[model samples]
Every structure is written in structure tokens, then in C-alpha cells.
Target chain A: MNARLYSVVFTFVLTTIFVLCLAGINALASGTIEKNEQLEFQRSLVYVFNIAEDIDSISDEKILSLYGNRIEEITGDQTVYVVNKDGSKELAFAVQSPGLWGTITALVAFNEGGTKITGIDFVSHSETPGLGGRIDEVLFKEQFRGERISSDPSARVAVVSGQDTDSKEDARVDAITGATRTSESVQILLNKAINSVLPVVREVVE
Target chain B: MAESKKTVFLANIWKNNPVIVQILGICSALAVTNNLTNTLIMGVGLIFVTAFSSLTISALRRMIPKNVRMMVQVLIIATYVIILDIVLKAYLPSISKALGPYVGLIITNCIIMGRAEAFAQSHGSVLSFLDGVSAGIGYSLVLLAVAFIRELLGFGTVFGVRVMPGGFTPWVIMIMAPSAFFILGAIIWIARTPIVKKK
Candidate 1:
């Protein structure tokens, strides 16, 4: 065999064997990976709905149980998760908004009337850790819990830095310091969620 | 051969450390060092990829055509990295998420390729594996040190546990990528002083 031809053949053969091995491994792990993702999404749903306490400490089975018993998935123009809370129906939906580095996908919940946010949990984001990534911290997400959403589409829920306001009616939350772009992204994200997705979700609920 | 297994292994950790000496893999060293947990996981992931890839490359050194050896080494390295990513997704979803693209980026870490081309090409499988592991450890040691400072000052935490006093002011700069450069530079400077003096 010519040396060049042999090299090419060897490379091709090696690539095929490696790709096959990767494919086999991926196939074997895909099921568990999918299940893990599904469970994570479910856990985030349960968290955003505020149906459970200390969600991090709860077992996977408990989360599955809570999701099963309390949450109902409604697929319409937008997929929404509905949970009956204290005799009132609340809705939660996934929202994708651009962060500094990449997309920030969050599960955002709304109150029974869609007038206020009930809770929020970030499903995935690529923001820099300890800076923009602080958006995932409880201190940041907790501000949205029961925060009033303004009727004004432009500034539905204001995420401002150095704000002294703590009133839920103001719909304002302090953004993480040193993360100005991410803070603005959060404001933009909320504006879109409130102005666009909420109406569609409300229609779906109706 | 005076270059025994111990020297091959120990050289990478200190005398010829990948991060501080050879200066390979500084990209990930800077990128993932902001958080201790993430840095630790990244270190382990890099070690896993480097060790296996080096072993595989050494085992096939004779068979790999010299002209196409680099391509073959990359294929082997990439296979292990993807497998690590898949396993992490299946069993450790949260860490997997935190590490995110850095796991996939392990294929591009220069340490694995450097070991493959420099040491593995001429070494035996077991010795090459040791070289790979030690190189990874050398890289990890520097990264973890950098992360320890960053996480401690930036988040007032160690491995996510709050360790600082209640009023300790967190330094915002420490949380960003620039801080890694300063820290890593200082580490390299400190680690190389004695070696430079002897030479």
C-alpha cells in the first residue's frame, strides 16, 4: 500500500471506530440523560410554583410526586404548567431571554390573575459565575416572588441596581453588582415575558 | 534511562509544570477558576481526558502514521471528552450544567495534545498515562490555588460554603476573568523563581 494511502485509510478506519464507540455510549446514556433533564425541569417547575419548601433538600421521588399531584401541563400556543394553590390556579411557563454570554432559560410563575409574579427558577444559563451568574442565586430570584407586574409593557418588572425599594408593588429589584449587562438583560427578559408571553399564556389559560 | 517513572511524573507537577512551566492549558485554567467546585470538577475532567488520551496515543504510536498522527491523537482525545460529558449529564446533572461548555472545550486543552506530541509519541502506555495525569495535576494545582483566592474573596465562600466574616467586603474584580491572569501570573512567577535562579 502507498504510504499516503495507508495513512488516509488508517485515519478513516480510526475515525469510524471512535465514532461508533461514541454513538454506542451516547445511545446507552441518552435515556438517563433525558430523564435527568426531565426531572430537573420538573423540579424547577415545582420550585417556581412555590408548591414545596427547601426544594433543594427534597428527594427526587418527592419532586416527582409533587409534580404529579399538583402540577398540570397545558399545551397551547405556549406550554404552561398550572398548579392549584390555596383554591386559586397559578400558571408557570418557560421564558428564554438573552444573557451576557448566552441564553438564559427560566421557569417564571405568575399569580392566579397574572397580575404579579409568584416565583422564578433559572433552568439554564451561561452567565459568568459569581457575576452575571448571581442571577441564579436565591437572593436575586426571591425578589420576583410575589412582585407586581406593571401594566406598562416597557417596564413590567424593573430590575434596577442601587434601588432602595423593597415594596413588592414597585416591581423593582436590585440587580447584581458588577453585572450591568446581565441586569439590563433581566429587565429586557421580564419586559418580553410580561408584554408577550404572558398574554399568550393568559389566553391559553382562558 | 535516568528519566525514570518518578521524574516523568514529578516533573510535570513542579519541575516542568504544565501551567506554570510549559504554560499549556492556561485558557481553561483562567476560565473555570472562579468557583472552587467548578474548578475542581474541571481539573478532574481534564485529568480523565489527558490520561486516557495519552495512554491511547502511546499505545498506537507505532501504528499512527507520522503524517496523520496529530489527527489520530485528536480523535482519541475527543472520544474521551464526549464520553465524560455524557456520563456527567447522566449522573451529575448540576455539576454538568455548571461546567457547561468547558467540558466540551476539554478537547481543545493544549496539555493533552502537548503530552501526546512531546512525551507520548516516544513513551510507553503506562508512562505516558502517568505523564498525562501529572500534567493535569500540575494544571489543576495552579487553577485550584487561583480559584481558592477568587472564590474566597469574590463570594466569601469556599466550595460554596460561607467562610468570611459577616462584614467582609467581596471584591467584584476577583469574580471576573481578569483576576485569573493576575493570580496565575503571580503563581507562575513564584513557582519559577528558584528554577530560574539555578539556571
Candidate 2:
């Protein structure tokens, strides 16, 4: 009985100390961590709007300066980031929606007229690493660029792994090979962003 | 077992190698071997955790109660893993994001627990740290070999740079988890053949 009770007490004390150590480190590093996350989000916005041609090669200092100089941040019903591209202002907003494993947050951008998609970027997602997670890759996001979305918007972009033999010109993007669930989730979120978010974005831009 | 430091380190690196011989840490070996860069990062992270945890466990071995020793070792190991995760997130966010849940997945890796129980519990701090580091390097060598084949075949690229001829086609099978199983099996077979012959 004595040894058993001692084991319990020993484990309790050891666990407490170790957890405290982790908590202390996390507390100290939280500020820098928050700053890095914000920087990544800003960088994603720049990439999504195609403000910087090569988002992968840009330096951290360059990203900060470019964001400061070009991008405008505004919040009303939802937070939005705007950048001037070609001639007029282009707006990109964060879309939080459900994914296969967990919440998927994507930043989608539209041209000044709100009829064509400028580009899209994933801010965060909880999906399988190699398979579903390819949504963040350049090939997937590249498909969204320059695709038209009507103001009334009956037919929008369709993500298909196979062929799309349609009569009308539907903006079709290729789904990732192995990640069918993630591709479907992305399709659902894209439609949601169109039906719900696009109207407010159009009103704000125009 | 009054072992020399040189013998101890060399044993973990080759003869008593963790991955090839003991067949430990195969979970990460399979999971992160698809690309060279992620595997390198995972290897370095494992080294950092293993070395420090071994050092810590060995240092505290005398003080820990015999009945609760495993629990204490786990606590020490987990603390270090969380610290590594925090450091990665703060300074190297892109790599951290690329690694994703794999950073947290290091906790469940059997290599750390194995070393803690086998070497650190009986050995001195510095020798245990050396053992941990060498074991990690051994694991890394095998992972890098597997990743080399996987990345080359999967994308016809090395470290994200195009290496293969423009006309060459990439094999899609190399991009998936099952490919790693095959490549790793081959690696173990080749690596062990040498040791078996020497014996």
C-alpha cells in the first residue's frame, strides 16, 4: 500500500513539473508565434491576389513592405484585404468552412468587377498531409484564377478529377488525384463562398 | 557493461542500428519518406528530441522512484517534443506547416521510449546523449535513402528541383504510402545483407 501510494504521488508531481515547463515555454513564445501566423496570413493574401508574381521567392522583409505598401485591410461583416492589380482594386476575403477532417479556411479573391476570380489561397486546413492537403499547392489554386462567376451565379466552377463534357462553358478545375473527400469539401466551400460571400464582396468593391 | 564511449556511439550508428537492426521508428520511416526535405526535418527533430530526452532521463534516473520511472521518462520526453514544436512554429513557420501534425506525431514514436528504457536508464548522461544522437543519424540515413528513391520516381525531382529529362514520365505509385513500404523493405534488405555477411 505504501509503495503504491508513493508511485501515485511520484507520477503526479513529475507530470505537474513537466507540464509547467511546457506551459512556461509556450507563454514565452506566444507573441512571436502570433506574429509569424499573422505574417503567413498576409503573405497568403499577397499570393492569392497575385500581387507578387513569385510568392515563394519573396523575402520576409519584402513581404512585409509589399503588404504595407499595397494591401488595404477592412472589416465590416467579415474581414477583407484589398490590393490594386492591373488598374483597379482586387479584394480577397477569408472563407471558413468545413473540410473532410476539420475546418478549412481559404482566402478567395475576386477582380474589381467581382465576376472573375483573381486567385485563391488556403490560410489553414485540417486534412490529410499528402492527399487532401494538396489544395494549397499552386496547381490547384492556379485553376481559380481568371475564372468568371456571374452576378446571378447559376453555374460556377466545377472540380472534376475526370472529364467534363458540357455544352456551356463551365469553369472546371481538376481535382487532386487521391484526395476525393478534400476535393469535394473544396467544391462545397467554393459554392458557399460564391452564393453567400460574393454578394457582400461585390457590394463592398463596387 | 563498462562500454567505451566510441564503441557505444558506433554500435548505435551501425551494428546495433535503431531502424535497420532493432526495426524501431518505422512509423516515421514510412510516413515522412515521400520527400527528401520533410524527411530531413523530421530526422533532425527526432535527433533533437532523443538526445535531450536521453540526457534528461539519465540525469534524473537516480532520483526517480522505481515504480514510476516509465511515467517520468514519458513526461520528460513529451516536454521536449512540445518545446521543439513551439520553436518550429515560431521561427520556421513554413517548414512547421509543411510538417503539420508530424511534429506532434513524434511523441508516439517508439524510438524515444526504447532508448529511454534501454540505454538512458542504465547509462550516464553524456553517453546516453551520444547514443541517442547516433541512433537518430542511423535512422536518418535509411529515411533519406528511401526518400531519395520516392521523390525521384514520384516527381522526377530532387529537393523540389527538376532533375529528370522533360520527356520522362513520373511514376504515380511512388507518391503514395505503399511505395515507401516497398522502398523501405528494399533498403532494409540491402543494409542487412552487408551486416549478415560480416557476421
Candidate 3:
């Protein structure tokens, strides 16, 4: 066989086989992968709503029950997940802002008055794993917990390099040691969310 | 002249290690060796890709024309890598997310291509599979060693556990790219001393 003809036939046959195999594998695994993704999203919702503690050990069944029992999903211009605690209602809303590498989506929960942040959880981000990615760490997320957002329009929760002294009204949280860019992005996102998303959510609640 | 299966299998781990001696797959050696967990996942993925790709290529060695041998080997390898990626996504989404680009980049890992061309194309299926497995092991060991030091000094932990004492301060350099070069260099120097003395 001529070199050209043999090359064409050989490559054509090999490509067909490999493609068919990949297609089969993708088809078989797509459903399970989608389910896992959905489950992970549910876990994030439960975490942000403070419905469950130690979510890492919580199974899919546990997350579903906790989420279903405590959180109610309201869809509109932005989806809000509501949590009722001690006869008062708290609302969790998703915040989308550009990060160092890609967009970071965090679910931020507010008290019934929308004055204090009850919880924060970064659902998705593309920051560098040990550096900027530490934004997802529990310590970092905990900084925003129980932080009050002042009535001033420009005020929001902030991540500082060192300790924040005004633990009561400062609304400042310590940032990751080596992740300045991600920290700054988070701060900006917090202010943006406080300014814009809060009012819309307030109207929804009222 | 066929070599013994034992020698063929052990060759890649020490005698002619793909990382230390032949130096085939260094790109990933530097990229994913910052953390122990990422290094382990990348190592296992490489081992799986190399072993199966080698086996498939060797089995079809006779039918593959000389003009398109490289093309066939790559196709087989790419198929295996895609399968690994999909499986990781389905079963272990967290690890899959951590690996990110390194998973897709396995298709271009020279170790798989080098083994397929040098050993799998000439040897029988069984021998080729052994060579592939050993090569991956060699690469994995080198990567894990580098990651151990990087993670320990850089993060004061191993696999995210705080192994370092309370007084220890983390080295910022260890977590960055430059640390990989220094660690990889020192590892090669230490690993190659005995290999060179034998000659």
C-alpha cells in the first residue's frame, strides 16, 4: 500500500475506534456525574443556610433531609434560600463576582433584618489551590459569620491582612496569608453584594 | 532478543527511571508536585494511562503501519486518559476539581508516548505492559518525593495535616514554582549517584 493511503486508512480507523470508546464512556458516566454535581450543590446550600454542622461527614441522604426540612428555595431575578431559626426567618442569596482567575459564586446568608451576615460559603471558584483557593477554607468563611453590615450604603464585610480589632461593628475579617488578590476580590464582592443584592432581597422579603 | 519479564518490570523504577535517568515526563513532575494528594492522583492516573495504552498498542503492533504508528499510539493513549478524566468526575468530583488541567494534560505526557514507541511497538503485549507500569511508578515516586518536601516546608503539613510543630513558620518559596526546580534538582542528584557509580 502507498504511504499516503496507508496513513489515511490507519489514522481514520484508529480515530473512529477511540472516538467511539470515549462516546460510550461519556454516555455511561454523564448521569452519575450530573447527580454528584447536584448533590454537591445541595450540600453547599445546607452549609450556607447553617442548617447542618460538619457537612463534610454528612451523607447525601442527610444533606437532602436537612436542606428540605430547614431551607425553602424561592426563584426570581436571583434565587434565595430561606432558613427559619427560632421563629425568625433568615435568607441566603448567591453572590457572583470576578475572582483572580474566574468568577467566584458565594452563598451569603443574612439575618431576618438583613443587617447581619449569618453565614458565608463559596460554592464555586477557580482560584489556585493552596494560595487563592484557601478562600473556601472554613476559617476564612467563618470570618463573615455573625458580622453586621452597617446601615451606610458603602459599608460591607472586609477581609484584612491582619487581625481586625473592631470585632463588633468593623465587619473586617482576617485574609489568607498569601492570597491578596483573592482576598481583595472577596472584599469587593462583599461590598457589591451588600450594595446591590441586599436591597433586592429586602424587597423580596418585605 | 527478549529480556526477562522481571528485569523489564524493575527497569523503569530504578535502573532506567523515566524521571531520573531518561527524564521523559518532567512537565508534570514540576507542575503537580506541590501537594501530596495532587501528586498521588496524578501518579495513579499516569500509571493507568501508560499501562493500558501500552497494552493496547502492543496488542495491535502488527497491524499498525510504520507510517502511522505514532498516530495510533496517541489515539490509544488519549482514549484512556479521557476515560480516567470522566471516571474521576463521576466518582470523585473533589479530586477531579483539584487536578483541573493536569488531567487533560496527561494526553501529552511523553512517558506514555516514549514507552509505546520504544518498547510496546517492538515487544509483546505482556512485556510492554510491565514497562509501562514501571515507568509510571518511577515517575510517581519522583513526584511524590518532591511533593513531600514542598508540602511539608511550604504548608507545614502533609496531606493537609499539621505535621510541623507550633513554632514552625511556613516557607513561602516552597509553595511556589521555583521550589519545584530546587527540589527536583536535589532529588535527581541524590537518586542518580548510585546509578552512575554502577557504570
* The best candidate in terms of TM-score: 1
Each prediction's RMSD to truth = 1.9, 2.4, 2.5
Give RMSD (Å) of candidate 1 vs. truth: 1.9
Tens digit per residue, CA lDDT, model 3, A46-143: 88777786877888899988878888888999888888899999898889999999999988889888788888888889998778988888988877
Model 3 lDDT per residue over B1-199, tens place:
5599888878889989999998878888988888999999999999999999999999999889887788788789989999999999999899998888889999999999999989999999988898899899999999999999999999899998999999999998898888999989998999899999999
Q: How many residue pairs clash in each candidate?
A: 0, 0, 0
Chain A TM-score for each of the predictions: 0.97, 0.89, 0.92
What TM-score applies to chain A of candidate 3?
Answer: 0.92
How would you class the docking of model 3? medium
- Candidate 2 off by > 4 Å: A150-155, A164-169, B197-199
Q: Model 1: share of native contacts present?
A: 0.91
lDDT of each: 0.91, 0.86, 0.88
Of the two candidates 1 and 2, the one with more favorable lDDT, higher being better, is 1
Q: Is candidate 1 or candidate 2 better by DockQ?
A: 1
For model 1, what is the alpha-carbon lDDT of residue A167? 97
Worst 10-residue lDDT window for candidate 1 chain B reads: B1-10
Per-residue error for B12 in candidate 3, Å, reads 0.4
Please identify model 3 stretches exceeding 4 Å from their true place: A150-155, A162-166, B151-176
Pitting candidate 2 against candidate 3, the one with the higher DockQ is 3
Q: Where is model 1 more than 4 Å wrong at Cα? A: none
